[model samples]
Target: MIYSEKENVKSLIEMSLKVIRMYDWLLDLYVLDFFVDDHWEKLPKTWRDSFRDMDPQHLGEILSNKPPKQLLPLSFLALIKSVDALSIPRQNTYKPAHKIDLKNLDNCKNHPRLKNLFLKHVKLKKRHEISMMADVVVDTAMQTGCNAVIDFGSGLGHLVRVLAYRDDLYAAGIECQRQLTEEARKLDLELEYTAKKHISPEAASKLHRPLHFNITLSCYSQLVKLPLPETMMNYGLIGLHPCGDLGPLLLKHFVESEHVKFICVVGCCYMKLSCEGKQQGYPMSDYVNRLDSKLSFPSREIACHAIEVYCERLMKGNYKDLKIHAYRAALERILVEHDPKLRHAPVRSIKHSDSMTFENYCSLALERIKLPLPTSPSVWSRGYHDLQQWRRVVVVYTLRLALAPLVETVVLLDRMLYVMEKGMSCEIRPVFDPKLSPRNHIIIARR
Candidate 1:
């Protein structure tokens, strides 16, 4: 199944061109500050403190030699015909029809199952979508008559719970974090108790554990283990989000192994990957099947351009007065539900921490904007607190609205195409609820 060098290069070039387009779009937006919010100044006293010395302007900036917007979500090309579906947010709702809760299928989260984690300030929807999409892949594999599933980057075992809870599917999850795995194991014990006792209303407990989803845990990589594949011979396939470099590793394994019958992979965080023996940036040229000629280095301001392109789309309507909560709501909508909207700028204060002293992150943010600071600390603090929370909403909302129309669409499309060339089939669809997280779209691909 090794593709000829020319074919590989061609595919690489196509994917590279796609990323470049997204980069160009983002670069434009950055220059316009269309992506920045009134509270952007709060970044300095809060999150920006850690990277202050490293040139804040350089963070998330596009590179002169790097490819453009290489890390797009998966909602674009795979579900283009249903593009309008992207306009709705998927965060606030997780209809039970979309999921089967181990306890009671009737009371599932109307949004994606993992939405609550965002409230706890965990890894946003970006990571959550990866798990849900992987579930679809696993479901497809099971429907196709496969029995087992191997989940890479199992994290807290969210994806594993979704796949293994069913009696018909046998699943195993591998995670590198021991603490998270331990937590997941403890959670598993709680689930077993729930399933055994919660058969009736009389069994409900105030101190109940989440219903158990059966899945084994391990610490193997595609490079180090054939057991995952060997065990799947008569069963199912290996499904993974395979963030960054792990993607290529999965591909290499899929091609090299005979036991694996299917692979549904959704790759992200490309700038964090290495290729052809290099690190920190992707090398599309190394994996594509063919190309007319080696492509040149992408533009340096492409990320800004992509951001601008996105802003233009997001600001199509009356988006002049977006607040922090609204902004967050919008982002939650886009990431979870793929809803598209032109959100206004949010005016509020920003809060940094729950434990430490209150510094009115948003007051500083207003100061950065050169606005007069309110005299009363309580009023200023309350205003700023509400504003800061809303500022995050605005920031992510602006991000999604600006990027949704084309940039996010194009970049994710390229990823789907890349999967196709590697001999895998894919389906890219929107998840519900955007404000819940910015990284929406469930990308399910199979080999």
Candidate 2:
């Protein structure tokens, strides 16, 4: 029985790999044809057929003169051009700040997370990305005519501070980490001081709009169950790269609630999402259950295969992992430039890590393929260096890069649908380069 079970599991893994391969091929085709070159004729017929099925507009016109049986490249180009017209650009810019880096490092004694994160990743000049993101959210809120903004998972007042700068837009940040929130409060003082220093008396007088921001370090999951400030319902809610299951939960709140005029969310970490109030799994789980009630996570077999594929890619070369968010943005850039089929590449769960030697980890990985170890475990152990600090930086960076587009797309589409469902008029556009910030994509949904 045990042997049979093991074999069954192995078979399932292989099947899952096959599915992933097909999925990756389709994504790669999209990246190659749409983002890189307009010439769709270079793709294989099987790929062309897949594109036709998933996105006919991309291939139909080029193939219009040609028989359905024989799809040509130029035909595919015309089809792709139509789809490209409909596709939103992930890179765009808004008004550049006359002055960047509003707060000094010495002044931000209280906001340790903000200070540490900014110091570690965001430099004085490059830090414009954070402020840029904040500006986008704030601008969107202003256009929507919202008086307040609720930023969930706000680390250190990056978005809150920007919103507070505006006289008409009141802002509140909901963070689960009390320490981080406290730190952000301290940083806000520095921000205020810096503003006062820079501003003339008249400008200071103009800045007197209560720069009131509050932080509550409680789980967002729990927050949903409780009665939040009624103001939350009235304000535009935005969460930049809310991780795993958290992002989707925000979506449900925005969808079910009548009070919110706008909710901008970006989600990442697909595998980490848990069963919320009604679903048994993420994404397909709900659909599967709705169909026949057998809703569950990707079977253990699928999980193992995913891990193997992920490990194989990492093993292919020693590459530095970018910041999780930045990495997410970079991956999107790569995808937009190279191939989309790998969009679901294995994500290393930086939020969770365990101690294992490189050799041990590799051994475990190879076991999945029933392949022998290429080198002796002793030899493999010699070269491995686990730098926790470096890994943390890279993990967050890469995670941001990988996650930006997926989460952005989900949030944007959800908002678009929400507008349609509510009989409100709206349009959404990507407002920044995903490469600059993993939480880069901005939805300018106007109603």
Candidate 3:
């Protein structure tokens, strides 16, 4: 049976606290550094045994060549087992509170107009996911008696356009980027012209005028200073994928704004969260903040986006350039050794073709960081050899991968707890298919 909203939030808080206690060990890569002796002792006996008994040749073969099945090194298997032991069983089991009834909606006359606009928007924006998500938002807004919507960080205004085209609803988009707002405005006009040409003028007139969908250019921080159009007051607030601190900011706005009555937000980019000083995104709830140990930056970074996709690919044995992690780790070690003073310096990511070799990767990384290339080719060969010898690094990396979802859960739950603490009704649901959109979790709240 599905847990009550209160029970769910309480359990989430408990799980988040547990993860915070183990945060340090999960993000420290050096603990598994083969160069450091006796470090394996830090891990459980089962984990150490898995690595000790693992065949280096077999590991190398799996990394270098694709296997027929989903073959994983023993160490990776053991790491998954260890992570699973600490996982919160209820985290992934929650279903959406409301499901989309596409069949019934298809029978409505307005469905054709909605579908046409959605198809046209998809063609212009090349994002099919937004169209699918808009379907749910529109349905929910209608059921809840929302007459207007204000989309935060609306990007290209795809959702805003869809909402405005619906009969009796007014929509507005607030975007931080100037270029995107301008592009969205242009697209709005084009969509308006197309609709006028296809439908009867009276029918098109029934639809809200496309230009009524305001695309404003302003940062989220400046939202209060800007005047909300009369049509936008008392509206539903929605964001497709508000990134990092923006997600929490949306929650804060929802609670403080007397005009907002509904909220639906899908958040991403957890690593970009501001976790320092009074503005930290995590531990927003008073209960989590009062804990003895506070959340750490390394832990927050591990919870960043794309981690779910990585875990899925690893489990499915889709070994397409899995060695990039080892290559990056090796490059980091080289940077540390070359200039000990720069040991803590952040390494900026450098993109390279999939076929790029370790030596090339190191060279590219070094160049990107403005560090001088090694005087001799021997240095490059030495680093590659060291990586090959310490093949267990990949296993350790995979182990760290397992902690991602747990870390993300803490971040998401902290947001939910913040809303629940205010006595607002809220629910976390898998609004989108995980396979289609990795960042599928949506936080819905209303008073």
Candidate 4:
């Protein structure tokens, strides 16, 4: 059932607290420590037996083949069913109560020719979903009476360009990477020249003279140090998909800055967030931070899980190429046995060709980590093909997958609560189709 924004925020915080209370067990279970740690024997007998009894050939036959869904053996199906039962209800976070209409922009009456020009330019360069998101943000900004827009973590200034061209608003982009900022500036110049050539001089003169958008090349961590335009009074903050800490930082800035009147942000890369120190991304609100029961951060892998994508893929029965997890697990087992020091070291990713075999994959991984090649490739190949070993890895992997939704719910809810606690109006809604853009939840707030 759908709940009000205040109710949803309360429920999410309580649910997250419960998960944190069981942090010790959840860490061991969801992090796949049963496979990573050397103490598999210490786990409960029932847990160990579940993995041991799984039929490797049955799993391979079902997951390896492409196409129509295949019925699994009773044992495999039973384990999956039990795991599904443990899943936390994520309906409130995954599906929003209200629908966001992109076509609403067509009704707005401001700069009809300029809007047409901006829409056509962005449509040709960006994906359909992204273009729709931009249209919605510009419409919102205009209706809210915002005189300027500042896009945080603007990658190539796609949104900034559209906002400036569509209306007479002064637009600016804050980008951390120098290379991306330079590329966006070049594209901005090209777009301006092209727009001037296509439209009449009278129409072009109506737009901001010179039609140039400012792009600042400085890390968002130093946002307070950056200078805002003194001439602009009201500003709208927009972020297409601000990754990691930048999302929370943007919300904090919006509430504190007198100039910012509205904000629309889509956050991503939860795993990259820092949970400790002054710049912690999660628990942004003073209410949650001051609670007696402290919250523990999930591992990088667990935090990175995209639960909505998993649900969509599972429903479509598109399970193929899952053997990569088994292959990686086998390599980890080998590393733990031989090189104790490098067992936990991060391995650099290498390109995986479809034709590459398990042995070749392991070799490339070892080489990337600066380790010597295995003395006997045949021995390792046998271990990978061994039915029991393969089944054990897949079963553990399934358990981790089940907890993904709960973890994502906590992260998204934290952002929503942070904005609400500051006495501002805010809501979380699905702005884009999950099938097209998995990170589709947009956190919209206004002061």
Candidate 5:
């Protein structure tokens, strides 16, 4: 019985690497290459035929397992099961923040901001993340003997504000963006000013004022120079969805610093991580580095998307935005014909709107890419082919998304194992609902 969560995570990591090695070829295919490179034909004929004419609703059902068929091949179904089994559950590991009572009533005072948002400033997703994340941060801090939390990439100090309210805990925010750091300070003050009115003078006086630092961790010198705020001898590093390499940087600090005794951070934008540079983010563990399977930029990009949320959209049969992929692919093919060098050219995102047409999308995209747009209706009518095959685009894309969780699992496991390699205990806790926030796995570690 693998009763230990840590052991279970490790077991999953080992298994994911084996599975990924087998499927790395498929994972390497970029969806953008669909129309430009005859990507539809590139897919295994059996796989293509299975989903060729499937309804969007049916495809959704098959993806989310509403019900399945001989519509999908047995081997493909087994592969899907293999990927699903590797993914960590996205249900919150700790109890809901509202239901959890603080252990020390004397020191852990409930902040008004925790329950009552200040003027609904935070979005629904943001509120759920900070409140739940803070609870886990506190719980882990208490367990690991960390008295202070230093949040990296702490935009707006939302997490810091919640943590600062706990009299027993000390919290500070480090943000690279100067504007956001200043705004966080202003908001922190506003929350403090309002919080003072609701509590006793004694309780108000006990409120810990969190320090905000405007520091970018671009170099090790800055990291080493990080001063301990107000004689806090021990502290934990934390982040609520630190983008790209920031989360890994925090983990790096946690492993290297004696002062950083604990960490609870969730990472996003896996595609931005450095794989070849000195501060490489992927292959953090020797185990992953030695694996025959490797994560490509396209795979990392795919891994970053919210599969669960998308699966829900599929289940609901919301295929309205589905045409965008086929349109973009058609445009890509057109661009390549116009200029072979235009292959995979950067095109600014054109927002989906009821008023927007395929031609309108192409015109805007062409304008941004500084390419000529077709003036003749005949050209457009003959140029883009088989737009009716949009469902096939979704099918292939959905198939790609099916493997996203396994990619995410592999990336997270590499981080966890990296920390463990340095004599620290580590685990990936699904602290947020994936539907609400996709990058929900919080990588936690302690020395």
Candidate 6:
């Protein structure tokens, strides 16, 4: 359904900005300097005092928006409530879960076409995304009398293959990676061959292979030509996690193109948005621009994390797994102490971080940088005692994590508001489960 919730979306935009603006000091801090800069000591004493020794299990529950198992300050409780209020609510509106069987796609034996090639090659997370995205695109196409869909930044063309399954519609993909484009074509042919055995030769002949464009969206737009078939005079746009500027550019494409009827786009890589340049992704609408609610790079990066999954880990008593934050922070302190210039330097990935000691982590981390290994155990022993600092890290992280959805709310609302300002109908819905795919919401707009 096309959304007429401009007022509601605008109100959410305003509230999210208000809440985020109030916590400016917290969200803007670089996580790499959490210990080196003494970030924990900077937390409000009341918050620091309450969470200093809280059990991991309870903290998890609280972060998950459940009622705290024990009593806490009204201020603390109020902060948590604000996060719940400002953020976007989990949505099942787009996916007809009751009507369809997305509860388990792997176990599903419904689709005889393409055999397991359509679903088995991908993980459960991807299956959920593709299923919901395909449903939305197909539904929108049917709704708007559109017979085609242009997949913006369509990686691997999983959705393209699914759309090609229907003889009634045509599917095309715009991808930059040559390998993915080739692979998608291979998969499409495999799909057709496998599907022909299930249907008559006449039916198979009616079906078309998905068209693949092995060019970057930017490169394609620069050329300014869309040589679409006459049958595809009307089409919709579908993007499953078009990173950074690509998402906004697709919206711009929809607005400018006369043949485009509707759009279903999910975006990721928020930190890559050029907020200040001529090619800006954020502040798309005058509504958000007027609010002056600019997001920091750190906040936008945090917005990409799986908050539901993080909370789930916390609730399951997987405290050791979550210690990566404090561990990195402590490591940051050691690095900065060695060389202040080494602050925020990139380190190679350390495997099995949960089981490794801080000293072990330091050895692995420092070897890449060629920094002298700390000769003093007592000097570096600071990280050992401050292992309790994981709670502090979690506490601060929870506050920032609380603001994450609100951050996302503002970004998505900015896009929606931009579409609305163009005098088009726009809607936002959570299509994938947050635990499985946190960046699940898609912005749907119709002309």
Candidate with top lDDT is 6
Preferred candidate (TM-score higher): 3 or 4: 3
lDDT of each: 0.41, 0.43, 0.62, 0.59, 0.76, 0.78
**Full ranking by TM-score:** 6, 5, 3, 4, 2, 1
Local accuracy of candidate 2 as per-residue lDDT tens digits, 29-53 = 3221222333234446554444434
Give candidate 4 regions above 4 Å deviation: 1-8, 20-34, 38-129, 208-231, 291-300, 311-318, 348-355, 376-382, 385-388
TM-score of each: 0.48, 0.48, 0.79, 0.74, 0.91, 0.92
Best by TM-score: 6
lDDT of 2: 0.43
Residue-level error in angstroms, candidate 4, position 2: 9.6
The positional error of residue 282 in candidate 1, measured at the CA in angstroms, is: 3.6
Q: Could you tell me how far off, in angstroms, the CA of residue 132 lies in candidate 2 after the best superposition? A: 3.2
TM-score of 1: 0.48
lDDT for 35 in candidate 1 is: 27
Candidate 3, poorest ten consecutive residues by summed lDDT: 210-219
Off by over 4 Å in 6: 1-5, 96-117, 219-224, 353-355
**Model 5 TM-score (2 dp):** 0.91
Residues 227-337 of candidate 3: C-alpha lDDT, one tens digit per residue:
666766577778887777777777887887767777889878776777766666666777667654355565656655354455456556564455665666666566666
Q: Which ten residues in a row have the lowest lDDT in candidate 2?
A: 299-308
Better of 2 and 4 by TM-score: 4
Backbone collisions counted per model = 93, 31, 0, 0, 0, 0
Give a tens-digit lDDT track for model 4, residues 244-279: 777887888888877788888887787767777787
Lowest lDDT sum, 10 consecutive residues, model 5, at 104-113
lDDT of 1 at 209: 28
For model 5, residues 53-91, the per-residue Cα lDDT tens digits are: 777677667767566755678768888888877777666
lDDT of 1 by residue, 302-393 (tens): 21123333333333532324443433332222222222232322334443444322234434443533544345556434444544454344
- Write one digit per residue (lDDT tens) for candidate 6, span 194-258: 77666666666777677888877672264147677777667888889989988888888888877
Off by over 4 Å in 3: 1-8, 30-42, 52-116, 119-128, 166-168, 210-226, 276-278, 344-357, 376-378, 389-391
